[model samples]
Every structure is written in structure tokens, then in C-alpha cells.
Target: MTDPDGPSGTATAVPEPPEKAAGTRGRRRALRHPLARFLLRRVLIAVLLAWGITVVTFVLTNLVPGDPATANLGQRALGDPAIVAQWRQDHGLDKPLPQQYLIHLGGMLQGDLGVSQQSHRPVSQDLAETVPATLELAGAAIVVSLILGVAFGVVAALRRDRLPDHVLRVLSLIGISVPTFWLALVAFYVFFYRLQITPGSGRIDPGLQAPPPVTGLATVDSALAGQWDVFASAVGHLLTPALVLALYTIGLLTRFTRSAVLEVLGQDYVRAARAKGLPGRVILFRYVLRSALVPIITVAGLAFGSLLSGTVLVEAIFAWPGVGQYAYKSATTLDLPAVMGVGLVVGGVYLVINLIVDVLYGVIDPRVRLQ
Candidate 1:
């Protein structure tokens, strides 16, 4: 538009082309997408959450009653009060809580898990040795749970109120009701003890020569290292404990998926898709499943993390080489370093898994990518 004063002498300038304006609007629209903003906000939230978890975990672990020095020294070291005091002072346990936390935080940031009081070996060494086995088993178990749980759920949705649905619901209810530790014991008895169907304990058969340096996961590293015998042994040994752990996750996820899918099946798009000449299977899988995936993925992710914390009972029952067992042992021995070490591992595991879930959400849903 032009000024009115010089209309006869000068023509007013015209606005830019509509296409350019439209392009600018499109750019702004892309920037303002809910998914993009949600992801940005999520990242900030994750940082705050991680910091909060670290601080709270550190404080709580320290507050847990017991002296690391005494836990190590026992009656002989406690005989001379001066010796116990000296030991505490030497290890900096005598320092103020604030100072101790700062030191621990600094060391943790450097990826240094402090030494175990009871074992006298570095906590990091123990973690490096054990974490992989736990990860392998847990990872496989969760994957299986997700796949089978969702599959069962889809079947139930397809066959609502039918025999298969009732059967799955009953199975899930039983799985959810049984304590994992109790289930592990029963499973061990039935499968390993009575039927000799699966090996009850250990990651691999003793006869199978485990690698010299059991690097990463025994199963994974064995495969990578070309130890097929060890791999077979690991898989066989893993099936029982992994299935035991998987039971609850599968149950929880299946229930969640069934509910979500059933709800989605009632939506308008679902009806419209069916109203079209499209097959029922296409409407269920291609349309309904995509719509249902977000909530199902979320529940499944949280369930997986719960297993990470709650696997202690199962680990103890099965003698599975998991962090839960290590944590339980360390706590019993009042080993501060080991306790904190396992805590870090457990915390980091969930954090990373959650991050992966968020990324996957973006991947599967175009709306998330737009955000």
C-alpha cells in the first residue's frame, strides 16, 4: 500500500507475492507444531528429572542406616574405637554430608563408581562385569513381552468376548497376581526340577566354555566372539529366568494394549475404514493399531522400567546375574559404594529406555515428527 499524499506523483508499492507469504506461514506453522514443542519441553523436563533423581538417590542412599567402615571392620576394627574413627576419617566418611555428596557426584560424573567397602574391589569393576548379563536378559524379556503381549491383545480385540479373549484375560490376571519371586520358584521347580525342560540357574551352561573375558552380554558377546556353543548355552539357560521376569510385563502390557485397542476400535476413523470395502484385518491393524500404539507404547515403557527396579526378587530367586542381586547383597553387607553403584546403573537404565521410547514415539507417529 502507498501513502495517500503523493497518489498522482507516485504509485503505492504492492505487497509481496502470496506464495512468499504462504511459504513464511508454512515455516511458522512447522515451527509451532505441537509435537516439536512437546519434544523441546520434554528434553528440559528430562534434565530436571535426571538431576532430581541423582540428588534424591544420593541423599537417601547415604541416610540408609549403617557405617561402611564398621560394615567392613567388624568387631576387630570396632574393638579400638580410635581405629574405627581413624578408618572413617581416612575414607572421608567422617566428612560433612554436603562434602561427601559433592565428592560422590564429581566421581559419578567422571563415571567412577567408588570402591565397595565389603568386597574391597572397585564398584565400577563389579558393575562392568555384571550389568551386561542383566541387560541381555532384561532386554530380551521386555522385547518378548512387548511383542507377545501386543499380539495377544490384538487377538483378543479381534475376538472380543470369545474363548481366546477369556483365556488371555485369565492368564494375564494370574500372572499379575502371582509375586514374581514366588513364580520364579514355582517355574524353577516345574521346568527345571521336575520336567528338566529348561535350566534353572546361571546365564550359560558350566560345560560350555565361557569366554576368557566375559565382555558385554554373555549371549551377545559370545555371538560376536563366534562362540556358538556358548551362545546356545546362554540362550537355553536364559529362557527360564527371562520368561519368569517377562510374565508380569506381558500380562500388564497385554491388558493395557487390549483396553487401548478396544477403545480405538470404537472411533470414527475405525468405523469409516470398516464402512469402506476394506477388510476387517486392515481396519484393525493398519488403522486401529496405529491409533492405539501411543498409549500402549507408554504403558509398556513404564512397565519395563518397573521391572528394572523390581527384578531384585526374581534375581535372588533365580540366581540371575542381575544388578538386583548385587544391590541386595550390597545392602545386606551395608556396602555404600556398591549400593550407590547399582543405584546409578538402575537409574541410568530407565532414563535411557524412556528416552528411547520418546524417540520411538516420534518415529512411529508422523505428528510427533512434525512437532
Candidate 2:
């Protein structure tokens, strides 16, 4: 296209309206902001992953070899065809798989996770009741893992080839090798049974009533309510199981951090910092740790996801009323709705953790945002 010629024979172009120019500039600014682009990209990916999770959860649950009506209604109800048919119809099990999936997905979109066949209650409701406990336990475990793992890992790296490094390596290996269930049993037996140092099973003392269900986390709720006795009991009950759940992750992070720190330590910048007479602590923290954060964050996020999902054995051992125990019960009774809800929650947890890790990456290194 050619520009129109003015009366003076000079080429002339029409100017954009002020509003249009302002809008264009705004769009350009948004596009130019690396953080905005990075976040938008990640958010879009998260949405796609979440959609895929719903599909996979629905398909896998439906594929299990059991009749929902039969499983929910029990053997006595099996004799009555009318009752069975009603149950199946009520739960949408009587429909075609595609139709059933559509109905299930629609309900999920509306925050309705369907009724749990085993509990005869909405799976969302059941999850609300149980998920907080699991979150509490997982949160504690991850915190413990991060602190001890990073500390021990950094120490081991600094003292590489020394006795402390060798000992920590051995301990981490043992932690990684030991079975969760076995470790839980031994911890329970030693602390609660033999030594009586920790409370056995349950979230709080059997005698004291649970605090008001504000957050579903006993310690937090009790403390919020100024019920220190309840809070203490909650902590007492929490420590053993949290420690048990943390062991493997702690070991995993220890090894990962050690490797990352070692790699960072060997970098030229680190050597340059040392040669410039920088304090050891400053070099380690400002230079070494900052450079190594990307990998550590990645592993920590994954470890947190594992802690959330793999609490089944620990929850059972501790008799903790969390998603893990709920999942075990749902699976045992073939409660497809409940199982799907659990699966979706687990998938969401991982996605959120990953997103947080990605955001941290951008914050720790500006290059990540550009990518």
C-alpha cells in the first residue's frame, strides 16, 4: 500500500488516534515485561496440565474393575435389581462412558466432585474434611527437610572428603534406602511404645476435643484459639509422623544440594571471590548458594509434591485423618469419585509447586524470565 500524497506533493500518512496509540503502547509494554510473559506462559501451561489431569483421573477411575453400584450398595443390596439400577442411574454409572465422563467433568468444573460411594457424601466435602490434615503434615515435613537438608548439605559440601561429609552421605543413603512403612513402624515403636517420648497415632490427645475447624490444622487452629494445651498436643502428635515422612525427602535434598553446591563452588566466580579476600560466609551465601538455588528449588519442589502424595503409609501408621488414609479407604472400596478427587488434588499440588518453583527461578535469575 502506498501513502497518499499531500497537496504539496509530499507523501503523508494518517496518524493513529490517541486512545489507539495508548492501547498499543500498553500491549507493547506488557509483552516487553519478561516476568509478565513468563507468568502468562506458565499459567497457560498449568491450565492445560490441569485439564489433562481431569481427563486422566476420570478415565483411570472408570477403568477400575468393579461396579460402583455394587461396591457402594453392598452384598445385601445386590439381590434387588431395582435398587441396584436406581443406584447406578443416580451415580451416572448406567450411562455410556463418554456421557458419564462429560457429566463428571461438568460437575468437577462446578466444584462438585460427585458422591463418594463408600462414604455416601460428596467427594468435595470429604476432601475438605481431610485435605487440611494432609497439608499440615506435608507442610511440616517439607519445612524440616529444607532446613536440615540445606544445612547438612552445605556443611557436607564445605567439608568435602572429611568425616562429617562421609557420615552424612552414609546417613542419607540409609534414609533413601529404608522403606517408609518400616521406618514409620520403628519410629512409632521406639518413641511412642518403648520410650513413650511421643504420642502414638491421631492428630491430638484422645481426651481433648479438637479446636474449631478454622483451618483444619490442629496446631494452627488451637493456637489461634489460644488453646495452648491443644496446640502442644497437636505438635506432640505431629512430630513423629512428620519426621518419618520427611526422612526420604531430607535425604534426597541433602544429596541434591550437596551436588549443586559442589558444582557452584568449583565455578570461576567462586574462586575469584575467594582470591579477593571475601569472607567465607559471604562467598558461600552470596555467591555459592545464590548460584546453586535453581537446582535446589527444582528438587525441593518435587520433594514437596512427593511428601503431599506419598503420605499414605505414614498417615495410616499415625492414624492421621488425612487425604492419604482417605485415599487408601477409597481405593480399597473402589470409591471412584473419591479416588478421582484425590488424584486431581495431588495433580494440582504438583502443578502449583512447579509454578512456584518457576516463579522462584525468575526471581533468583532474571534470565529465567526471558526464557
Best by lDDT: 2
How far residue 49's Cα lies from its native spot in candidate 1, in Å, is 2.5
Candidate 2 versus truth, CA RMSD in Å, comes to 5.4
Predict model 2's lDDT versus the native: 0.89
lDDT string for model 1 (326-347, tens) is 8989998878878888877888
Clash-forming residue pairs, model 2: none
Error of 2 at 138 (Å): 0.8
312-359: candidate 2 lDDT, tens digit per residue? 999998999999999999998888889999999999988899889988
Each prediction's TM-score against the native? 0.86, 0.91
Q: Residue 260: error of model 1 in Å?
A: 0.8
The lDDT, on a scale of 0 to 1, for candidate 1 is: 0.81
Model 1 CA lDDT for position 368: 75
lDDT of 1 at 285: 74
